[model samples]
Target: MTRWVGPWLLLTCVFLLMVGNVDPWNVLVGAGVAAALLRWSGRWLMDGRPPGKLGPRRVWGFGVLALAVLADVVRGTWRMMHVILGPSPGAKQGVVEVPLGERTEGGARVSALVASMAPGSVLLDIDWERRVMRFHMVDASRADEFRADMERFYRERQRAVFP
Candidate 1:
């Protein structure tokens, strides 16, 4: 069924990568293992959720989101390096609360991933009821900047892609 394709493909690719081979026998073995795993755990993997709707606009939004995340990664990495290597001795570390704009579970997950992927930030806690996420920053002095940036990301990038 179409529902099985993603897990099967993902497992097959993982098996192939693990074995580092592409021979017919290897492919068959991978497929067999993938099938077994899917049979045993597919429901758990899918968590009873149906597939989300996808269209050209959503696809394009995903691309844009990827670029924006990439840019944030680079910027965060630079900031981290500066904190580690720069003459300024102590970079204050503290947590900052960022309000979540997207109400959907998918949007919240995407926002968490995008925020945590940046080197300078790590998602510490997500208060779903409060619609806020708390993040520990490498430099607490820049908490305002971090909050603003995350808000911008949620507004500009994550909402379109995940909504």
Candidate 2:
């Protein structure tokens, strides 16, 4: 029963997103589709893994991460605006390779996601074997700062939520 919650909520979200309504008929159809999809894909998705539970600590950690991301978004937006509207449009642009360090696969994925959420940076590639993520940044002159900030974020923010 616990295993069903994640898939059911995912399917419900997708159904609502696609159909854009919650009429009774639509809900019934969504439930039927969700059930069929769950039955068909449950084995592959579950993969004999136990369901994950979020305790208070994890919840608090997630909240902290969310706030940090929001702050990063605002700061990135302001910096991007300056770069765009400034006298010089040709700001230093390059890709920075950030070592994944001891981050788990899930933690690495979340790290990439959070890095991409910033306005001027995008996740270009992830090398699992090398355990590195490549990000293209608009202001690559601050590569060292960027790398340090990413390391801190992964170590401090993402580790608790995803590790």
Candidate 3:
């Protein structure tokens, strides 16, 4: 049965939002416009099928990251100054290859974000085929220890938010 349902509902919303005038003439005009749009949509877009449910928690994840990045920026500035000027705390400098997860895109982003935000670590590159993130970290005398620390930090904070 061809009846005015979805398009009229949408047009009602639009007309009410645009102009509070509710009269027969306005209703007729709005219905005409809405029906034209519905016809166009039927031809060009999906045939009135509802879209998939989008994830709502993505914004909250972003909020969590905004705060974390702010803290990291301030702390990193201080740490960088210390590393450059203050007495040596035995900051290690080398390429520490850390094995990554199978989730290529997410794992790479997490590794880069965490490494760049941490005190003295920078993600140099990520090898997708090898599933490893090559990073440059400071203040670690051992590569294994540094990789463990990175993995632990991600599990504690990043995983909680992103995963």
Candidate 4:
């Protein structure tokens, strides 16, 4: 009924996109396929949990978080360029563990993705039981600074968007 309309339209669009055609025949085929999937894949698609609401506030927060991540990427790239092109005698590359406090799985995943986008850093692992994230950094000497930065980001930026 009305509940399935959005998924049906989305899946139909996906089908048309994958097939790269928009003729009447393709549209009909896409709609049929979308209907069949929606009919059979309800449990698989949603599990038992209800879908999360997406309000305007959350959308705006997400946009702000994206811009913040981009800024981090640019700054990291500039710092990495210096390390790469010139002699960085102070640089110490290694892994640093940062406390992940009480983040939900989705929030932690987003943090990992955004953290990894910064140049010269990679998210190595998320230790759920330990409540920590391990990141490999080009300059482990700044581990304390890195941890502080991450804490600030999680508190100020990601908390609103993902929490």
Error at 127, model 4, angstroms: 1.0
TM-scores of all candidate predictions against the true structure: 0.69, 0.69, 0.50, 0.67
Clashing pairs in 3: 91-139, 92-139
RMSD to the true structure for each prediction, in A, is 7.3, 7.2, 15.8, 9.0
Each candidate's number of clashing pairs is: 0, 0, 2, 0
> What is the alpha-carbon lDDT of model 4 when measured against the actual structure?
0.84
- In model 1, residue pairs whose N, Cα or C atoms come closer than 3 Å (at least 3 residues apart or on different chains), thus clashing, are none
- Tens-digit per-residue lDDT, 1-163, candidate 3: 2555865678766975687787888887877867765653453233544222236565565567667667767876786677778576545566778878533355456557666776677777778778888877675456687677567656655554554
Off by over 4 Å in 1: 1-45, 48-51, 88-90
Q: Write the per-residue lDDT of candidate 2 for residues 1-163, one digit (tens) a residue.
A: 8979888878977997799999988888888878876764465466664224678988899999999999999989998998888887646888999999998766776788788998989888789989899999998888899889999988888788876
lDDT agreement with native, every candidate:
0.81, 0.84, 0.64, 0.84
Sorting all predicted structures by TM-score, with the top scorer first, yields 2, 1, 4, 3
Count steric clashes of candidate 4.
0
| lDDT value, residue 24 of candidate 4 | 95
> What digit string (tens of lDDT, one per residue) describes model 4 on residues 1-163?
5778898999999999999999999999999989976764565464554334678988898899999999999999998888788676435889999888767776776788788899978888888899899999998888899989988999999988775
Clash list (residue pairs), candidate 2 = none
lDDT of 3: 0.64
TM-score of 1: 0.69
